[model samples]
Target: MLVSFSPSLLFTRYNSNYSTMESNFQGIVPASDAPTKRKRPTEAEHIPTAPKEPPAPEFLCQDCVKLDLSKAFSVEDTSNETTKMAFAPGRWGYFNAWAVDVGHRYRGTIITNCNLCQMLFNSRVDEGDTKLDGDGDWLRAVSFLEICGLVAYKPHRWISKDIPFLMLFSNKNYDLYENRKKVRHLIQQSGYAALQQLNQQQAIPFSPKVLSPVFDLGTFQNWFDYCNGNHKLLCRSSKSDLYGTHVIDCQDQSITQHEPGMPYVALSYVWGQPQAQKAVNDGKRLPAQLSLLIRDAIAVTQAMGFRYLWVDRYCIDQDTPTAKHEQIRQMDAIYSNAELTIIAAAGQDENYGLPGVGKNRPKTRMEAHIGDVAVVWAPKDPQAAIKSSKWSTRGWTFQEALLSRRRLVFTEQQAYFECNAMNVYESFDIPLDSLHIKDRSKSYEYLRRGVFGGNREAEFGRLNLEKQGPTEVFNRYLSNVEEYSARKLSFAEDSLNAFRGIAQQFWYGKHAIHNIWGMGYQTPPEERTSSFVHSLSWRHTSNCWDLSQSPQRRPQFPSWSWAGWEGEVQYEIIDSKQKSWFDNLIRAVSVENQIDSPTALEMIAPNPDATCIFPVVIFTAAVVPSKLISFNPNAASNKRWQIGKYKANLALSSGSVSESQFAEDIHDSHVWQCVCIGAALKVSFVMILKVDDGSDLWERAGIFAIDCYSHSLEKMMETREYKSFRVR
Candidate 1:
């Protein structure tokens, strides 16, 4: 039995109510007028502008002639409840049809007046196929069978084999069956307003679903309830109090302390083109004129039955240095313990409201009908939408998402719920039992959950040592840093601050002694020497679009860390082939970092034995004296320098100071030193440094690799001088 829903109930303002399912079939293309059976074609011919009327026919194909389309088409009312109605669902058929590679003549006649066929043919013709004449005007009488499951016959075979035919199936069949070899139809906009209403009504009943007309508050509340009650991995313990110190009370329109065990929503958004933010007055009330993004966030928080919303701009006491530093230090905890983070990922900046909340989001899906069949044009990937948004490019938002246990993302297309355990979307239902988290290539949650195996503490414990050999755990950290470095940061100095949460999570989550300057080292005092050297061996990529953009030093940060640079760096983990070279190098004797305050470095350093007074790192290692033979600024990085007699290249880490200038400074002295860190494939990786200000301290000039096959390993080590170097 066909179930018919009242259009008024499905769409509140719809004027056209659905009549009882029409059983009678008349005036929907007479069976006798339908095309007769014919041999299938191998090559598509030019569709003439006007085909002459056919004479009395041969035998007919009953299946093709019996298609009744009037039973499938209907019009729906829009939000205004006017006399004009929008398009609605109609009858649709699904078949596992084999696409044929043939000409147009032998193709059998089927549904000769199909609007779908005409649209498809016309669209294909518009792609500059001059060899095919007749501007699709003749397609008004062409058979649907000619274009079924295929773009066109031979002469118009512009479609690639990998491109799937856009087949439209019945709503029920589309959800019930797996997409295999199916027939496709062209999806066109029959009516914009009508199609938008149709999408809401048609998509109302699926599980893990979102209601139509966007930002239906009740629907969003249900998603939170479901995830809260069902996803064990996303739940926070009652004892946890990592939420922000201050939160905005949505109902009171004021800021207040976040109570323990109370659920609060955090917000992640781009604060594009800075504007002055006034501090909350004595009353603790929110500012009257808030950005649309924050205003929408408050409404959503209230709609989800939560009173408190944590927005960084308002929650943190930005004017107070101590409070700001305290909040910044706890960034990891702030995001991790939130009930869920609301990510405003639709627009360029905070001024643009969240789509579907305060703003009326344009419909992303459109539907139209042909006879009894309905076709739709819908975008399926939510990840693509989020990735394209301006919010994804910001440096701070990276850590915000990475630390959050659950995130409710609002993109222009739709809203979606992402957690370590599952992903739910507003557009349609996805069966959770069949979903494998690792298979989501575009999802950040996939990377988040996979890195720590859904339990950060346990995963950290398991990877603290290289008992059986090196694990991918450390490599994952490097991969994340590489991505983070490429992202845009509003202030270059905030580079480390933005990535602090991720760094702290790894540094202090389990074995504290394993991390130094955001790089991973092995545990135990004996193993750290080699791990430390390996961590320092990262190199800037040579294939960058412009070398000037990267390899630029962040003067405030130490050169030993990737954080000291403005761009991406890559670390090739020590492999068995290069183990000999790594073992041959001089081991680090001791390392110490100077910081302003001990409490400032994530409150506590994981390594209690190491000093963390300031941002400078002092270390001692064997250094080799080498002459600066020549320097070529124009050459590619691999052949840019000549150190001693070996062919070498330098990865310059200074953008402000030119290599030519440095060469000029050392022209008469010609004194240079190479601190060999590791080697592989007869190549030695070394850090080049020079005496700083005629003092005992040495400043890193750049990193270089020398071809070492010409000299023996012992010969290379014999020329070294043991010395202590302090780099700031």
Candidate 2:
């Protein structure tokens, strides 16, 4: 049954809808009474003012939504609760009143969250409130209203398609790893009232110089057309410019249709699964359950009368950060002044009633809230649930769920949002546009590669190396790699070619889609049949945005063997266990190791024996310090140098740096050498290494490799490490 939630500090109430019409039903216009349906002469459709449908709705069948999470704010006085409640209506209403509501239905339930600001005007009626008279008054009202925007640290994929865990501020402003800390701190403790001083308190700036609006929402008769192609105020735009700006730039220029695609709907993509196919479908409870949990929590606080929900996406506009940051910085006052700070997380021990398992793992934000709600999901049928549990057996599944829920929110003496090691930088909100992750066009964005800059399709040369003659394909890839001046690929061109070659040959080697790994389109929930069905969608805001999945995006000077390679460097299992961690895996050594020779490199490499290629991935030192420095972590700190680049061809250099390990091992100082052996291929590279460790900052260095691999491993033969692992 559909349930309407109450207004609470965590869940915003919507009894008073700002939209003109509650629903859209098509019928003949009365002309006398308020016209509910307008059959405009085609000319009126082109008029400055026209009625349109509201934003896409939320899923109706969702039985559960995640529990509401509170802003990480700190308040010292319990007496402040009443005063906080006072600021609830005016402040919250003033900002959200401009938003238009859209009802999202999944299964049988309707989600009450509004879609976007545009939907507000789209819900026009023929009456005095919001009739479409070709006038200019309403546009003026909206234009004059101070507009605010927010730019977050998340990639467009995370913020626009999936469950975007919001950031309190930009990663550019602070360190990125700070998120892990804040999350940990809140889980272990709950004295959260001392974090109020560190919020972003800057206000949005506005300009009044430009004008020429459109129809008014309240009167519907007034019209204001400000721009005649000359002056520029954001609101004033031609239809072409408006449409051009519609998609809202999902960040990858290569994939933009340059036109608006689908709009956001809370649970729309999930419930459509069963209907899409048959018994092969699986539903996602993450988003739906999270929403319901949040709604229920809002109810407890709303019973006491408070309303203001601040989610990052719809609530805070992203394009305008100054204004959004100010509101976010005051999250302490905003949340503390109002009613409640609902934590969406559940405690593993409490919710699942499995205390033993939870006691062992470290506490986390999600684990602390288990006592808040009890949940259980019914598969479409007993058999379907059985099939689904093939991977995560029911008993283990319960433990996994329990393991995920843990949290605590502590506070500093200062009364502001907690911005510290423990809190992590989560903004306590989800992004407005996170649901679009399923769209193929937006998800596998790197595939398109933006070769010509328009929303261009990716040009994948058929990598049927066997058909094209492996030599021909390999030579073509080499020719292109050698042509580039940069040692590594700054773009996706080289990588894309490599993977397409692998996809044509080896994807079927393991003979399974699950193991083959797409640079797949943004994976859609309704389409996921198993836990392993993952899309190469961006996972987090941890970096700027990774678009290197497709073959068209490969690195420069990359081996065709490295074509399907992903991440900082390409790796292959020359010999690996079916399920052992130590199976022999061959990795193309990145420039990080400064591996002048393959044998010494093997001692200190993520994947041993892959030659040091100049185009190897340049990883952040924090993530892979050994790769950053030539010395191993076990080496003395004084002996360690942070230098990353290695000479591309060590054999050619007459006075290359001395090998310290060999020097220590030898009795004679006469330039002793180490390790002689099998045939190995070595490719030298001089390259620019760069990475986005969330700061958008780039660092580069010179480097090279001499890699060694045995014929057995090259044949994908099992090594001691490879043979020991098994999937089960």
Candidate 3:
């Protein structure tokens, strides 16, 4: 049995009024147990009068009181009662450090007596480790903390016994200061008391300040109002036709048309693989048997004081291909024009309802406290919650999140409100005015400058030419493509469609180019030809190919674009120092679109039945002969190549060239023709090509770069044959 303490005996040292053994006890303990009060020895020193704290309550457990928090207790000190109480065998403790009998008693006392002790014990558990029990089963928890040498306690602010005692556990013998700061940064503070602490001490890291068991709708309303009233970038109305689309009347639970620019909430969630969708047949009432996600979203919309909600499954007419395609095309406007997009980033499928939304809101926040300090185990970083969720991995959800001006993201742990200006979470109780200054270096800021011309702040405008260059926009587009290309798509054909909204957003207005037309090119024909060819320098990630790989190629997309391949692709970032040597060898005279004078909107929203129009680049470039000298199956790009006396690097596009085919090319003495597209520094970027069955059309064999001096390249260019190659 565990050693027990009577409340009556514990209270004897304090005032009779303080009978409560719980955290809220607000009476002073006997002076012997009080923390050494700071002394003002000199009358000359300026003294600031502070509000007198209520009596510091006496702890029921004597073992907890005797702990000298300032000193590090070694594992050998496990024999002491205070040591046993402090380092109880729980989730994070090293079990081997304690004696078997002592650990059993420690566990018993922790589970039964103090909630703070119990919570701290169960705070952090490593993967593959089992829960330590009072019955003497330590499970598979190995002694990793043993290396830290000694555990010490650093006391935090404390007042009423109702407010549990807050103390940081660290190893004074090792890295105690750094560990304390790291732990403090991770813990989420709560209520006005914690906020007061934060206001007083800027050094105290109380990030992600608030987390409650139940989500407050009033808080969300405040955030919504703040974003609507203040965020200028987010407030600008979308250019797309918002009134043409349909939205569900959240109050009526029926699909209805709203007036122009009517505020509606858009739902972005994962449509689980092979799951049955409850679509609105006549664009009227919601289905009687609705998914949990849809039902919860409607409730959330109504609660947030929005009359309309737009969910693709119900809003878009899935049966009518024309209507569906039209809605798909206006995705940029649909999400951007909405008051805010509700991102259901929790759970695997639509069936998994939003946490803390409806009835049976599972309790996610865990609360505990010591004598006068409330305690909570720090939540995992908010970004990890979204990154690991099923919703983040989907292709369709990518554009839905990026295009939105404001996002109300709901994860399993907590809800977050992210706009172009700032991102705030329900876990933080920070004042709205102080949010921008709060250090979020550790937290994930979902706002992207690459999408929709970045943040609302005057200083960070992505389109500001004075602050940022034109190449920065194209570079940002490449970065977006790199991220979007890695995302999973249920249907291979929907790959381009999934990313079209972001493409459309990038192509809109003076922010990028207007004459991009159908090819999804970020630059217009008037821009430097080098900038246009730079978009085509994307190489597949090393993980894209394997020994038994038959890559699923999207034939609808042209070979020059990253969309033609299945896996992730990345662009080689150009250095500013190399601009002097940069040269455009090929001229993109014109992009021959299949349709005559198709607008950017028409190109962005293409017909699903027809193959996407490939923009055939009609250009003249010097074609030089190069041979593959060696190949490495492990290296994704930059395999050695022989170009006369000088060597070069070849990156065979995985969409068309396989390792076996590349090996065969090298063995068979195949002389690959390198079409010089552009030059950067010492190397000349080339498109390795092969004739299509002796036809006039030339398909992209691979992309190569010859490692030679600019003068040497110019020498080679004079002798090389310039051919007018029609590349698709």
Q: Which number leads on lDDT?
A: 3
What tens digits encode model 3's per-residue C-alpha lDDT throughout 155-251?
1220010111122222112232334333333332211111112123333222333244334555676666666666545345565666457888765
Cα-based TM-score, every candidate: 0.61, 0.18, 0.65
| Tens-digit lDDT track of model 2 for 581-610 | 111122222233234432222233221113
Ranking by lDDT: 3, 1, 2
Q: Which of the two candidates, 1 or 2, achieves a greater lDDT against the reference?
A: 1
Count the clashes in each prediction.
20, 125, 16
Model 3 weakest 10-residue run by lDDT: 155-164
lDDT of 1: 0.51
Q: Model 2, poorest ten-residue lDDT window?
A: 264-273
Q: Given candidate 2, what's the lDDT at residue 301?
A: 25
Listed per candidate, the RMSD to the true structure in angstroms reads 15.8, 26.9, 15.3
Query: Model-by-model lDDT, in order?
Result: 0.51, 0.21, 0.52
